[model samples]
Target chain A: MINTEPSRTRLPAVLATAKNSDGARDEPGEEIPQTISPIRTFLMGRSSGAGVDLLFYGVMVLCAVSIFVIVLAIIFVLFQNSALSRHQFGFTFFKGQDWDPVSGLFGAWPFIVGTLLSSLIALVIAVPLALGVAIFVTELCPKFLQGPISFLTELLAAIPSVVYGLWGIFVLVPLVRDHVGPFLLKYLGWTGLFGGLNIGVGLLTAGIILAIMILPVISSLTRDVMRAVPTSQREAVLALGATRWEMIRTGVLRNARIGIVGSIILGLGRALGETMAVTMLIGNRAEVPHSLFSPAHTLASVIANEFSEATGDLYLSSLIEIGLALFAVTIVVNAIARLLIWAVTRGAPARVA
Target chain B: MAIEPAGVSLPDNTPGPVPASEPKSTGPGRNRNVLRSVIDHSVTGLSILATVVVLAPLVAILGYLLFKGFSSLNFAFFTQAPRPVGEAGGGMANAIVGSGIVLAIASAIGIPVGIGAGVYLAEYGRNGVFANFVRFTADVLNGVPSIVMGIAAYSLIVVRQHHFSAMAGGIALAIMMVPTITRTTEEMLATVPGAVREAALGLGIPKWRTTISVALRTASPGIITGCMLAFSRVAGETAPLLFTAFGNQFWSVKLGQPIAALPLQIYIYAVSPYDEWHRLAWAGALVLIVLIMASVTLVRIFAGRGVLKGNS
Candidate 1:
């Protein structure tokens, strides 16, 4: 293979004449990263042989560039398909609450409201619980229990959304209807949020389900951020003779708060866009629920429930426009969360891998 | 502060940070010490309570699923299709097969593009603006709702082809899988030390060759687990498959034909007002969760191990 070489490059000389694995015996091309691959020697004279190398690089660049293209194409497709609704409904398409397709009136208001309220409820429940879980796993857990507990917490994120939906249908819905709902009704009815007749499936049910669904996302990211807090900070606080909780609150939580907020927002993004579980649990109504116990439809669930059978062009266009709005909102929210997380982590590779 | 002053005992229920200034009298100082311990212990209790609140639902759901689904599983549940309205015994065999096919196509498309993009981001996209653009886009894209992706697939392929097909469903799932795969791959690859790359370069190996054979091989385990993560996540997607695969009732394997998937079938059954279908949905869900949990368990183990440990 080396006989084909025209010029002398140090690589070719090292490859064709290098010692073998023992580092003492001489065998050409036997020392790989120690020497060069025999394949390199075979193409020595034809330096144009970089064609394969260049092609591989080009393909990778193309694939990377395709991510940009895919996002653009999605934005274009959503906007193009949503044109009719975007035009007829005008720029304020998200304003009104009416969605009567029989008369062709469509507005994103109710869906937006449902998405907001349910996600906000999820955030309200998830943030503290997730933070506690993160803190427990990161700071307070016993050495023997930490690994298993962390693994169990992350496993929550791995469960499918559809399965969560099924569980919500059978298990959660009954629990809410039989116990939690009546209890809230008897005790907290004056607040007006839990007063409606409980049918077992409603915004609050979906919210609770969503809280469970987003818990892993929030806690995992929060854990990573907290873990990213330099160990020195913890040591410094401890050196001051602070208690475990005091050290954690002062050294870890305070440092990790920004990223924790970021993680919560990311969880909120998941809750807002979650489909199957919410669809199964939220009752798929178009109305804005007067009480959290009442039924409602979210932007994502609305799309999932309606898009399949939407026949009229206007109806289809409106659905796509709703999807477009969801696409844009989630993207912006996620981008903001990413920025905040990036600010906290400062480009350090997150432990998500 | 363990300023426990072990002899001091105080019963205070005030909720605030420890006062900056102690009364300086040993009596007040000791009380303040007890106050600090009280606050510390209470915060620990709250956090533990938080952990319990989060985990209780998980245990309840998994336990109920086991109770309901295990009792319902039968031979027919794995080997047969849904027997029309009244018949008692049938399985999601077709949906299982369809899910396999769709996942194959998704893995075919998603893994390569995702890993290739990840390779670029880690190796070449270090400082460039375009790389940052790609990174930001990947994060945002990861957060894009699955239903929206379903609509995109419906518009791009289903509408154009004039039918729901497994291929369209596969494409939708593939798109969803990309951001995750890309991110995981990039992170895993980043953990491959640069000195290794420099060594390969020093040995006169081409940059691409060093990346593929050297870096990728070193990072393969993490990357493989990353792909599995994407696979398991996509396996349970119902929203993306709603209009794309469209959830067939009977067996259909052709790429062009609508196909059933485990998640989609479970969804259809769960929403239907039939006791029999409800049972099947439970069984199907049980199967899906079991399958997903197996892979998830792998991820949990690998992820918890801190894959880059000594390399970094």
Candidate 2:
């Protein structure tokens, strides 16, 4: 095969190198006159670098496949560690409501409800603002303001969750407890969502922080979705004598609505999985919060708050079970969001997601 | 019907070229125009308000951090060990050192593997089923949530060893970094024109060599940005380190032992009821945020310059 390379045979350097040592083949009619030199083979990777080529390709493929391996291993590890709870409670672990650690009765229903409630509140608060931000940045803002706003959005996304937690404790919890809670209680107390002791740290505060944390994610993806909307759509709407908002509503929003929903869903996944800030502000109670101000626990917050000190093997296993549930849920949510975003951005190769 | 001049209105909402059949002077038509313009202005106002509302928290967070962080960042804050409970005052020097170590280990393992995966996707596996599968799984891994990642590291390494180790924490962070870096690197490599790869191939370079020396070189800035983005993110994560690194009180850098981290330390401090620990928590958060913001800014600058250069 060394002398068989039609492309490299034309190169004088290759021809010269080929002549320096005999080919390795000893077939009856082959042109190889001598055995291959170990030094030449050592200096030049693989025979004609074919082995090296294969090696490089193999290494890269392995590296790429490592992602698959990591995910599978995580699933396996979660399942393996959570076996005690899996066998003990079986299906009832989900419906079990008593999370009293002292009694060792673990039910994920309250945490599930808490997580869903808080995340729903986050979506409610963030989606409209995120949509507005996306619209402003993409369609309404001055060209000069676009870059800074985008940068700021990225910065916001990069802000640490723990930092958000820190701020939540000192600033947001107090604000929510003192002013917002009281004001809402005074005016809209009949809604029942606001009915609580309102000591500040609760699901409502967690939801607010989560909303802030997720705002940039939704808005950024929404902006990308809108950007992927062809300019001709806008042009056609404007050519129809539509106002700017009318054009945006008819052309951009209509076209990118699925992707915008996908973006919101992605934000929801983030809000659901968000741990530190929620742990700090959600008051670390293992209860299904009836009101927004009531203390609550999320699957992730519970793991983060108690995983370090989960006393018994069963206790740890129960926590791992919650973690497994979180893992499964987030994976499903993210997969859905990715598919939806991909549907909208199919034509745009630059879609980062 | 009002004969108001449509030209008097803002050019944005003014009807461009009206058809003859659509009478502009009709009362309802003019009223509709007025209503449409009102809707336009209000939406515009609302969108701007949205921007302001979003910016308000960002400003408050940063501003508050600055105000509180500076006062708390004494000389001891950067150089001395944190004080024990019931002690007077101290700093988070151990955490700063510990963070550097963990992040270094994470980046070391993360960046190269991530870049390798990305290069494979960009250079070889364009539309292959396997490539798409890998990409999908990578994304799935990315969305697994940090707490789960913590749990994963705990079960995988901590349980096996029966103890916490910085190695486990580093591995957990590395795992988180991989998907982000891989995706970023892939996208950046994709942006490198086919012509460049073709040119390298035309010059008789090996496929692997061309991918490395040419395509990768061109995509370096974006790849760096991605790596930095991953770094900053994992650097600030606390949950994953809670049971992995396990947050040492005294300074420890051994791979098999628990180590302190800035975010983890900040977490421990933040939740503590002590006012002094709270101040230290603010200071730690300040440092973390500033570092993150600086890296993000640097990434934007580099990415912008690279993009402009590529276009030119």
The list of candidate 2 runs beyond 4 A from truth reads A1-47, A349-353, B1-29, B299-312
Tens digits of per-residue lDDT for model 1 on B172-289? 9998889898998999899889999998877667888889888997887788889988999899888999989998999899999999899999999998898999999989989999
Task: Kindly list the per-residue Cα lDDT of model 1 for residues A304-346, writing each as its tens digit.
Answer: 9988878899899999999999998898888788778888898
Model number with the top lDDT: 2
Candidate 1, residue A100: how far the Cα is off, in Å: 0.8
- Per-residue lDDT of candidate 2, residues B117-234 (tens digit): 9989988898899999999999898998999999999999999999998889999999999999999999999999899889777755677777887888888888988998898889
What is the Å distance of residue B10 in model 1 from its true position?
Answer: 24
Q: Output the lDDT of residue B58, model 1.
A: 82
Query: What lDDT is obtained when candidate 1 is compared to the true structure?
Result: 0.84
Q: Return the number of clashes found in candidate 1.
A: 1
